[model samples]
Target: MIFRPIVPQELNAVLAQVRPDPSTAVSADTVRARLADGEYRHRWIWVAEPCPGRAPLAVAIWWGSPADAHPSNLDALFARSDPMWAFADLRRRTSSAPRPTTDPRSAVAAALLVAAHRVFAVDGLVPAPDYHLLLPSGWRDRPETAASVAWRRRAAEGAGLRLTAEQLRFERAADRPVPSLSNRLSFTPEPDDEIFVDLFRRCLSKSLDTTSTRKALRIGAEEHARDEIAFYRHGTRGRRSWWRIARTTAGQVVGFAIPSHNSVVPVVGYLGVLPEFRGRGFAAEILAEATRVLAAETRGGVIRAETNLSNHPVVAALELVGYRDRTRRLVFSAT
Candidate 1:
């Protein structure tokens, strides 16, 4: 079998081979747009072929930097592979399709997985064991669709990956009732990244991101905090505004909040309290302050936030501030 990056000229042909459900195929226009779009690093789209000149068996595409890319919804762009001696195909086809026929998707998917990991290593990208799979809100009810997703999940596990956590997205509208402030904590315009780094490090004692990072990559918590400082700094795509530091009346540090705009939508980038200051409701206050800061700028608009499912406190705090549940995403990892 021959596996390699699909050439631009052959993109349309390879895309034609991807027999996805209606409305899921990547259009030619979309491909062109991504090529022209500079914000994201559109890594190479890979394809696998059976033999010297046979048609492709599967394809895989991911978003983000090559080494650390996340799977978009269409990650399963698998090319049908021949029936294999594997239980994955047997188990996945149970509910999704008629058992009388062969399921080539799994065969193609397994090949693509091996190829993808090899390319990831060759390209010097940060290694992640698994790619995230997005299961829509009503996935379980749709038996056929859910079956296909389950098949992909099994294929992922076959490649030594496992389901991790659901990253829940939450949103608060500008109309959320803001707590009246007596200025008990002072908010400052902005400060150096180093200052935020120290506070973030302090918060890492029980941080979900830190825990996940440790489990996934075996990195220390301090390394995770520094990476977070870089992330919050670069993740803001719109106008860079005040990244506030909240302090007490006596000028002691209370917490920090990042209120910024990503493109047109205002966002609560990051809000955290010192580990020693937990249980006093500092998270909600910082969240509310950040919400107010963004809300004032965006009338009746929304402030978006995402927290890992494991972080119950962050989710509770978001709910306290009128942040409704928007959506949930499953994060899968493998090595």
Candidate 2:
């Protein structure tokens, strides 16, 4: 088997072999766009084949750069072994760059590290110690796999990687009726000017330590404040909806949740309650209201969210609102 550069004509053939689910597969147009985008690096399309007269059996696609290269990692790992040798033969022609010496243990590790680095770099950071390989549903159970748990453990340990435990442990409490805070706080779908300003302020306060915001501006929380407001208002730009809910009696902006159908799953992109409103069940009430709205619209899909794992209160609120722990990702500092 030989790895070689892929061309536009081979897109469907490779897609057929890789068999990615419809939701995740990039369309032909998207593929062409990425190819045209000068920013993307190390994009590769490869095919694995057996001895002479044997057709190719598998296809691999990888992308990203050398300041954070990963497709190289996969090639290095696969090059070391037998049928895997054929896997290495399939490579896409990419601009030349110096390669890392460390051997990656699995294609999954290569793919994950590439993705992790991209996310971190986009936020102007590097991969963190707590980073773990996020395996999609069926990868773990495959047979004929050279990638083993022991190999993964060794590779991660060598690279100083730390992983979160697979199980999501939570303290269970007796079932009690959700407190009737909905009546105490009226749920308004639309936010007037004053309410929008208050919501923006609350989001700015909550996101002071966010990976993206912290990297870009040291003291520009106010700027980010406006950006958040604009993000909901004009940035969404006729594509998604935004709303704010405030406590009527105090007239304080208790909490805000943005439920958008922008991805494969409906996402509650932002949610927060002011510091003074903390511990008053206001966050839960806001989430419950959002969930009610989503349910009414028959939004029966996973809702994804991420926060600093150290933020126990926010994690607790998510659990209370029916979000199961999915995976923990580490955000590393970019030097």
Candidate 3:
């Protein structure tokens, strides 16, 4: 099979293969919309075909910030239900033994990713972009969710993207009563970005958040902190002024809260307390502040947020602030 990215001429044909699925956030319409916004590009969408101009047997779509030079996530993957037949046919024609596999489509998907990464790596991107699987809460016990995730999980691992983190997604209506913040702490916006970066650096020292911890390991804590700040500044629709650094009434630093928005809706983007301030009930305080900020802008809409499943304190804080569990996100990466 030949594996390569589709061209502009093949957009319609390639798009036809991006079918809708209840388990996934990706769809043909979503792909088209992101493509128009430059978040998805032709060069980042790869396909596997039996020959030139033939219909693709599999497709892999990647997503990134519009201002980014390389894609960050493998948004969706699609493959024919019975790809082994095609492989068997090709093997027979070449007088070779066919590889054995009960799940052929996953193999095809893995090969497609491996081939695509060679090109992407040459362009200075990482070996593999992360793959996000958004599943319903308690997905492990759901048959359909488990079945749908099985093949993709195999494909991701085969392509060198191993399961990295699992996080709980959450949402709360703006109309929900805002949790009260602690009077012992005060929130204020700092004009200089460096101060927030330093705060993030301090927060990362013993953070339980998987993504932040992984990034810190990969690129030092300070750099990771700066990268996060840059993401909020350029990659999201959130305003910088909305960020608040929390401090005690006596002016000792406690933590910070970032009430932000993605392309869609307001989010409790980020909140963290320093190691020294841990277990002081400051986490819930900052979370409440972030929720309050977001609720004001959403105007009776919903605010979304997420935290690592292993982060008990943050999870407790989220629950205390009235953000209900919405879904779970399983993230895979080559790291």
lDDT of 1 by residue, 136-243 (tens): 455568787677666566555544456456677787777767775356778886657788878877766666653345542556656767876775666545334657
lDDT tens per residue, model 3, 1-335? 77898888879999888885645778888988999988999999999888888889889999988888899899898888867776665445533222444577777787788888878898988757899888899888988778788888888887889756899999998888886755989989898989989999999987899888987999899899998998888888888889999989899999998788876789888888999999878999999988888777666388999999999999998899888999998998898
Assess candidate 2 and give its lDDT.
0.44
What is candidate 2's CA lDDT for residue 165? Answer: 38
What is residue 45's positional error in candidate 3, in angstroms? 1.2
- The list of candidate 2 runs beyond 4 A from truth reads 1-7, 13-182, 191-198, 206-209, 212-219, 223-242, 301-304, 327-335
Score candidate 1 by lDDT: 0.62
Question: Who wins the lDDT comparison?
Answer: 3
Q: Give lDDT per model, in order.
A: 0.62, 0.44, 0.85
Write down the RMSD of all candidates, one decimal each. Answer: 5.7, 9.1, 2.5
Clashing pairs in 3: none
In model 3, the worst 10-residue window by lDDT is 92-101
Q: Which candidate is the best by TM-score?
A: 3
**Residue 126 local lDDT, model 1:** 42
Q: Give the TM-score of candidate 2.
A: 0.52
Question: By TM-score, highest first, what's the ranking?
Answer: 3, 1, 2
- State the displacement of the C-alpha of residue 110, model 2, in Å, after optimal TM-score superposition: 8.2
Candidate 3 Cα outliers beyond 4 Å, as residue runs = 89-101
Report the poorest 10 consecutive residues by lDDT, candidate 1. 93-102
